[model samples]
Target: MVIAFVISETFSIYSFNGIRIQAETWAEALMKKGHKVIKVNPWDKHNWEEYDIIHIVGPCEFLLQFTSSLVSKNKNIVFSPIIDTIQPKWKYKLVSYWGCSKLRLSCYNHDVRLAMKNIKQIYVRSQYEADYVHICYSVPLSKIEIVPLSYRISPCLHYPQKENFCLHVSILTSERKNVLRLIKAAIKYKFKLILAGSIDSEEKFRPIDQLIKKHNNISYLGKVSEEQLIELYSRAKVFALPSINEGVGMVALEAAVYGCNIVITEIGGPKEYYNNKAYIVNPFDIDDIGKKIELALADDNQQPSLMEYIQNEYSLDTCTKKLITSYNKIVSC
Candidate 1:
């Protein structure tokens, strides 16, 4: 099958969000499964109808407009709406259906009706996201497929060396990332913390830099190569990313496969993936974060269940199979 894995944008070689990485990963996974996959962005000039299925990869106003156009032509299409909002569900319903969208206040609201229009399938990263899509867009439960971001284990990716530090990988300056709060938690708990990933602005993140200098337990490594990242994950005792919100927390998933005790935000879908294995904490509470990190540090058993669960449930092969199954359903219709 020829597939167009479309996204709002593509990732740069140095920087990207979850959506870009997932799109690239899916395209590669599909190709390995004997399907022809094309990486497409909204601005790409190719004939989109040439593909067997139009698989839209993320949510944006422009992408919604393009998807609806394909829907009008009766084109076979599926969606990976990697979207979420911490705002009240009532606000979404009000703006989407009750004419509040015309005010042009909320970026999400103006295009939600368009986003909710005819599509054969909607794929999401977690059950929380599935519920969000259904509630916000009024999409049917059956229409949404939960395919969380995945990590496929291989020989080259190293194993658990288990050092005594907590690892966090994200844009350090992102307000939603909540890295500053996590730093405070680490300091409070007296745990060693290693910060990774690209910093959007050194100037904006100077406060964090100062904190790193003042506290020996906290240190930022900026960004590291894939090799360095795997090594860090392999060495770290605990992996923590207590963000304000996450679509599925792919970094945490990656860390879990390396056998790092997971301490992640409870706000998003990490709970569904980790289940009872990893430490789940409130993103807004510093003490909760600290306490959970402390608990995670104490879990020295290196229980094989969390690693096995992630490997079995979130393998790239499993993700591709579900995606292909959904693709077949839409194309057959």
Candidate 2:
């Protein structure tokens, strides 16, 4: 069997990032099953008909044009849309409406519709997304299957000695990520807060800049290499990203594996996976979120042995095997 992966982004540099890791692990797993897998951007001008299977990693319509432009009815094309849903209760209606709009567009688009007409299988990450796809697009439940994205435990050389701060590693731009709200809470609680990853834009950064200057408790460590990020995981006592919405909180899982207590919003897939290991709060309630943080910081039993939990549930080998089983079933059908 020959399997090919088509993604729109540059694969070499950013491939190790969260979603790409699933793609890589799936390809590697398929190889062990005697399938030769090749990963390419669907937007790249490559011969598409040569492989036994062509998998699209996301729903980017641009890639749809590039791939279908070259080949007519590539029999093995598969759609994998990893939906990231993170929204507060009040915002669900608006988000669901937006999703419905996207679904309508997908049904009408020439490339996407053509693929839908020809493709035999669609893969989704969770039951939540699978149900949404069915409700929003009216795609048959039989045509879609649930395959959870498995995360590999990051290699740990040294664990940092944790102090009194909580950590957040998300794109810092969204007002819903609630960084400003977290900052105000930090001032009241006097607990240090460390932020990692890129801020959404410079305009959003301006207010954050003022807050950072005014308070010693909040430190912004801009975009970091993966190693440095893991180092941040090592030192933090608790990890929190009270995003208004999230597809799957990959960072939360990473922090959990490192034994950091979690404080997260009840949104999206993270709500499904938290499993009593976190402090789930209402994303809209800033004061309650702050009090939860304070309570978590003071709790003695907050940090459990998360390394074992992560290894059992989200190891690379386990996820790869599950994905391969789905692929075999899809392709053989």
Across 1-333, the per-residue lDDT of candidate 2 in tens digits comes to 677887656445553465676677788777876789887754566656677678877655564454555347467777786666443333433333342334645322334434454566788876677765665445689889876665555644344467777999887877767888887788877888998888758997898889888988888988988889877888788888787767667787788777678888876667566566678888887787888888877765755545456656676667667667766776677
User: How high is each candidate's TM-score?
Assistant: 0.89, 0.79
Model 1: what TM-score? 0.89
Q: Write the per-residue lDDT of candidate 1 for residues 177-288, one digit (tens) a residue.
A: 8998999988888899999988778797998888889998888887898888888888888999898977677788888888889998888677788867888889999999
Give the top-scoring candidate (TM-score).
1
Candidate achieving the largest lDDT = 1
Count of steric clashes across candidates, in order: 0, 6
Off by over 4 Å in 2: 9-25, 28-34, 41-50, 62-74, 85-117, 152-161
